[model samples]
Target: MARIKPQALLQQSKKKKGPTRISVTTIILCNLVVVLIVFFLFSTYRHWSQRSRFQTDNQFSASEDGNAFMDAKKADVPGYAVLNTSKGFVTVELFKESSPEVVDEFIDLCQKGHFKGVLFNRVIKHYVIQAGTAQGLGATEDWTLRGKHYNQLDMSLNLKHEAFMLGTSKGKRNDKGFELFITTAPIPNLNEQLIVFGQVVKGEEVVQEIEEVDTDENYRPKSSIGIINVSLRQKI
Candidate 1:
C-alpha cells in the first residue's frame, strides 16, 4: 500500500468541507425565506384588521310609521349639532336647505362616531379652530362618504359669519363634511362665499377656551382640542 502524502490528505479534507459549506448556505436561505413569509403575513393581517374597523355601512333607514319626520327629506335636516370638546360643548343649528349635501354628510359622519377622538388640527387666533379632519393615519381608511359628489354653490346668500356658524370646508368643493371650523372672529370675506350652514347656539365659553389655548408659531395648538363626542339634540 502506498502512503498518502500530507498534501494529498489536505486536498481530501477540502473536498469533504465543500458539502458542509453547501449545507450551511441552504440552512441560511431557508431561514431567510421563512422570515420573509412571516413578515408578509403580519403586514397583510394588520391591513385587513384596520379596514374592518373603519368600514362604514351606508344604509339609511326611514321610519315606517306615519311619522313624516323620519322621512329622508325631513331627516336630511339635522335637528341640532353638538360637539363635545375637551374644553366643553359647542352646539350649532344645521342649515339643511342652504347646503343640504354638506350638512347631511356631517350628520352622517357624526352618527358613525367618526369624529370621536379627532382633534382640531388647525387654529388661527381671532379666526377659527378647524377640526373634523382626521388626525394621523386614521383618515385614509374610509375616504368615501357614500360616493357623495362635491358641488360649489354661489356665495350670494345673505349669511354672516358668527362664532359657531359652520361653513363649507376649505378644500375642493364637495369635500365639505370632514373638515369644519368654528369662527373665533367674524370673517366677513367668508360671507356667502362659503356655505354658512349652522351657528353656534350654546357653549360659546368652550369655544373661547379652545381659542385661548397656547399655540405654536404656525398657530397649531401646543395641546390638542380633542373631540370627546358629537351628537344631535332634538330641535326645540
Candidate 2:
C-alpha cells in the first residue's frame, strides 16, 4: 500500500466537497419574503375581524348608570351615499378621514334600509335639513343597523359645519345617530360639537329644495317630502 501525502489528501477532499450553493443574499431574500407574507396575512385577518365586529348584533347601549360604550375605529376608505328623495337625487361624499366610525355607522344603516322611506322630518330654511328618524321628532325609539341607536363620535376633528356638511343630530349631545342633518349655510358654531361625517358632493340644488320646502310650526314638512331610498357604495 502506498502512503498518500497529507497535502494531496486535503486537495482531494476539497475537490469532493464542491463549491458553495447558496449565497448570503439568497438567504436574506428568502427571510424577507417570509416576513412580508406574515405581515400580509396579519393585516388581512385584522381587516376581516373588524368588519365582523362592526356587523355583529351586540347592540351597544348606555347603561342607566350613564356608562356608554364608545366606538373608536379609524376609517379605512371613503364612502359615497346617494339619496333618492321625492324631490331629487342628492349625492354625498362621506369624510371617512375625519369621522370614520360615524361614517361606518351611517353606511351600515343605509345598507340595512334604515333610511328608506324615512321622512326628512325637520327642515330649517337657510339652515339645515334633518332626516333618518322613524319617529318624526328626536325620538330614541329608532334602531339603526348597529343597534337601537348608533355611536357618537368623540368630536376630535375640528371640521366646520359649512354648507352641505353632514352632521349627526345633536339629540342630547352624542346620543343620536339614526338622525342626521345637512347644513345649507356655514354654521361655524357647530364645530367641535357634532361629527361632520360627510358633505354633499353633488346635487346642492336638491338639498336647497328640501330646505326650502313649506314646513309646519315644528319644522316638519307640510306635505309628504320623504326619502324614497338611500344607498351607499364604496368609492372606486
Candidate 3:
C-alpha cells in the first residue's frame, strides 16, 4: 500500500471544513427563521388583545348608564320616564313641580304597571296621539274600566293641556291620571285646557311613526301603537 502524503491529508482536511461551514450557516438561518415566527405570533396576539379590551370598555359604559338610570328611579328623585314602544324608545322628562297631580298619577300608574301593553289610540299625523280614551279597540284593555273616572277631577287648579300635555281630561275640565298626549302641530285650543307636563327628549322618530299609522273613520289608529313598558330613567 502507498503511504498518504501530508499535502493530501491537508486537502482532505479542507474538504471536511467545507461541509462543517455549510452546516453552521444552515443552523444560523434556522435560528433566524424561528425568531421571525415568534415575533409575528406575538404581534398578532397583542393586536387581538387590544381589540377585545376596546369592545369590553364600550359594553361596560353602556351598562353603567343603564345602572345609573335605574338607581335614579329607585330614589324617587325627579327623573325622566323611558317609554319603550313598538316603534322605538322615547324619553320624557317629567315636570313634577309644574304638574304635581298629573305627575303623581303617572308615577302611580307606572308603579302599578298599568301602561304596559297599552296602545296609542288616536294618532293624528303631524299632530299628536289622543291616548287614554279607553276605547278598547287597541292593544290592552285593562284600563278600560277606568274610563268613567278619566275626567272626573276638579279643574280649580287651572291646569292647561297645551302641547305635549300629560293630563287626563276628556275635553277641558276633566284632567286626571291615566291619560297622556304628545303634540306635533300647534293646537292652541289645548293651551288653557290640558295640563302640559312633559316633553319628549328622545325617540321623536317613534312619535313620527305613530303619527303615520293608518287611522279609522274616527281618526284613531287602525292598529294600536303598543306601549311595551314605561319605566323611569335618569337624565344623564
Candidate 4:
C-alpha cells in the first residue's frame, strides 16, 4: 500500500480551505449590500413623510365652524348679505365687529352693485367657490372700486374656514380684492392669509350646490354661475 505524502495532504487541505474562505466572503458581501439597500429605502420614506406633513400643515385643511367667534345670543343680530346667485339666494352674516374695514368695503361694494353681474367663474369641489372677477378670467377690470391692487387688511380675529364662510385672498395683482370665494369645507390652512368676513346664515344649501358644478382645470365652472344680485341689510 502506498502512503500519501504529507505535502499532498497539505495541498488537499488548502484547496478545501480556499473554497470555504471564498464562500464566507461572498456571504458577507451579500449581507452588506442588503443592509445598504434597506438603509436607503428607509431614508427615502422618511424624507417623503416629512415633506407630505409640511404640505398638509400649510395647505387646505378643514376647520371648525366660522361662527365659533360669535356669541350665540348676538349671532342673529349681525349684519348680513343676501347673495342672489343663478342657483339660489345665500344669506351671509358679516363679521363687522372683528373685521370692520373689510366688512365695510364689501358692504359698500354690494350697495354700489359692484358684484351684480359678476360670475363665480372659479369653483373647486370641497374647496371654495370663487367669483367677483369683473370680466371673468382676464379683462383687467378687477378691483373696480379702487382701480388698483387691493390692500391686505389685517385679519382681525381667528376664524375657521367652515362651510359657507365668505373669504377673500390677498396678493400683488389688481384682482386681489375683486376675487371673493365661499368655503365649501373648513380650510384651517387659509386662516392666516385669507380674510373671513362673513358666514352663511341661510341658504348654505345653495353654496353646496355651487360646489357640485363641473369645473375646468382652472377651477372655472364649465357652465356660467352669475350673481343675479347681491344686497346688504343691517341686523335687526
Clashes of each: 2, 0, 6, 1
Q: How would you encode candidate 3's per-residue C-alpha lDDT over 1-236 as one tens digit per residue?
A: 99999999999988774433457889999999999999999999999999999999999999999999987765665568888888888888888767766677677778788878877776655345755655322333322322222324343444434334344544333323356677754443555435677888777777777777887645667776778999976563
lDDT of each: 0.67, 0.70, 0.66, 0.70
- lDDT value, residue 60 of candidate 4: 40
Pull out the clashing pairs in model 4: 62-186
Q: Which stretches of candidate 4 lie over 4 Å from their true place?
A: 1-78, 134-160, 171-177
lDDT of 1 by residue, 189-221 (tens): 666335567888889888888877886654557
| Candidate 1 residue runs with Cα over 4 Å from true position | 1-72, 134-160, 170-177, 191-193
| Positional deviation of residue 69's Cα in model 4 after best superposition, in angstroms | 25
Give the Å shift of residue 70 in candidate 2: 22
TM-score for all models, in order of appearance: 0.54, 0.54, 0.52, 0.54
After TM-score superposition, the amount by which residue 204's alpha carbon in candidate 4 deviates from its true location, in angstroms, is 0.9
Residue pairs that clash (backbone atoms under 3 angstroms), model 1: 150-174, 155-192
